[model samples]
Target: MCSFKKVSPITSTGSLLCTSWKQITSTEVPAVSVIANNSSCFQRLYAVLEALSGVEPGEDVLRLAHKVQALPNVSFKGIQCYNGWNQHIRKVTDRQAAIDLVVEKTRKALQILKDNAVECNYITGGGTGSYVFMDVDYSNNLDESGALVTDFSQSLYVLSTVQSVVPGNRAILNTGLKGISLDSGVPKIFGHRDLTFSNGGDEHGIVRPSGNLKVGDQVWLIPGHCDPTVNMHNWIVGVGDQVWLIPGHCDPTVNMHNWIVGVRGGIVECLWPITGRGPGV
Candidate 1:
């Protein structure tokens, strides 16, 4: 919050060449933007998080913080990475190639900050489909030789009772777009390794089974993405008193909930209210 007055002339290249400056104020004050319809409310806000989609060049990305810092009373807090999420489904035959691409892009972005003398101490990013590669908190999980240590994919279960079973290894279920998200991909059928799923409509899920499925039989589905599916519900109920759930993209899903309920041993345990549940005004 220190203020300084210019005491040097600008260089011919249009860059600041201040070798000496006078301190005008030593008092600290929170930064705020005066514009409307923007995230300028400093009372309830601490920082701003901008999305880095990896689409822009690294040098261009560095200009984001430079521009913000050049403003009158606004500060750039940090950035959120989304390269993993957007590049998860790229048509790369080699799995390592995909991982390498994400790693390279992120390294370039960090290098931009290093070259620009901007201190990026805070950062956040990831989604269910892409967190495993970016996350460092492995906790107790580990893979062979500890090469892979953590799993961050969403594990929500979608159980649908079969309503109709037809020939040609095809069946219809009770779950559809109204209860799940299909943007990332179709859901995988649990316990049926050879089954595939597709969106039937708003109220139905089309399933192709490698084996037989009868009417009234329960079929479990693993959503390709978990966030938007949960946002489509008012309450998430659990059977057998258990549910292992995670959101694919937490930001939008969190904005859709007014309450989050927790249960244990088939009994209601707690209810937490969501104070921020809408697109910002």
Candidate 2:
């Protein structure tokens, strides 16, 4: 009843090819459409045809198009053009140029499909790193006003407990590399702008205290990258008198845990199990 694309390695042109095609047609799944946004993908389409039919798919685009159209339940979908650089590009002009290139490439692909009488209906591809918490990497993107985009408010935080108080205005937290991620940058202390958080060790985080922090005191930290940080924890405490940790990324974070605890007015409202927690689920 549903259609989706599955990318898998094509090992052989014999049984594996027939099996792959039969597996799709034997199920209730709808026909899949091909995507050829670049020259490599275009060449791969011909390679796929040659493997299935045992006939060499030459450089003739029209011949390849006819071979694809002759398939039982397969259709040729349009191109997918993506510009990764534009997702986090700081300058407006540079981002615009990247977008222009994506458009140009997409148009050229579409034109080829049209000239060859290939049915291409979908043109899909564009993504943003910016999400709910707006991690450090996404913060670098600038708006047309030449200032940082501040439309979305950050809602994710890592709640940590102070484990030790050392000299030189330094305090150690229970959170560290195992509990938080520093791929983008070090975490920031929430509600304490003057204080700084640094990687201490595998299970410890060093912070320059604001003279008020002490052992057993809890601190909220804004993660540099939300995806891996959330993956490190099993639970996300909702809003309450107790500290709450909101995940930066939703999809991968949800996949890392088995259950989602929903709370309302400090009471547990519902619990949903994540049946699909990993690949091959």
Candidate 3:
């Protein structure tokens, strides 16, 4: 049974209304509880749950959900918790532990809902980065050439040319933190695996070359975090042929672009406009 209503407003203010609704829903129970003692604004049929630990969410969220569901005139729909902090662990075992923790917490909440006789039909695990598998096994699958085996994470590349080389095996590049995200970590130099990249500032990057690298030589950087990095740019230039860019974080990156362009043989093929652009306040 689908207990959650997929509501959509056909107006520009739809998103704003939805955001406001979430806030209102979260706080309405407390306000109603206070009012129920004196006035008939609402009936305090369910108990108001106290706050639990800051890191782990508990019955308090479900308490609010129960209250919302009890509203006479309002349509009742289940909640969707949008938390995915634990899903970003690099190690597979660590990632599994994180997911298990989330599931454990979810199980507690579901029990609370069951006790309250509240129907929760839908629940979401996470958005993008949480579910993305960084390491993929493509051992059996191979191209017809038989020499090429596909790896998942080898997609996006920040191609830049070497600007200058200084003493102590250091080389300066034309891109830095402003061009790509360093939140997850610094990007590694593609091809020159021995070379390490460090932040020089917003507009510059320092590359410590393990081998000889001359000026004007090509250098490709694999981004540490792909979301904010791609958001910092407007257009993606494709070089030789068709390329599929897989983002480290897909949700935020998708919001950064206004248009998606398709190019073939160095010629513009098609363009599609993106509806949403997330702005930082």
Order the candidate numbers by lDDT, best to worst: 2, 3, 1
CA lDDT scores, all candidates in order: 0.45, 0.51, 0.47
Query: Model 2 off-target regions past 4 Å?
Result: 1-72, 128-131, 209-281
Off by over 4 Å in 1: 1-55, 86-96, 102-116, 123-155, 164-171, 194-196, 211-281
User: How does each model score on TM-score?
Assistant: 0.47, 0.56, 0.54
lDDT of 1 by residue, 78-195 (tens): 5555444433433334434665676677678878888888877655554454442221121223444544433454323444655676644456776666655555456555434446
Top candidate, metric TM-score: 2
lDDT for each residue of candidate 3 in 173-194, tens digit (9 for 90 to 100): 6666555556555665543454
Residue 25 miss distance in model 1 (angstroms): 37
lDDT of 2 by residue, 44-124 (tens): 232333222212212333345554555443444444565565776787888888888878766765676677667766666
Better of 2 and 3 by TM-score: 2
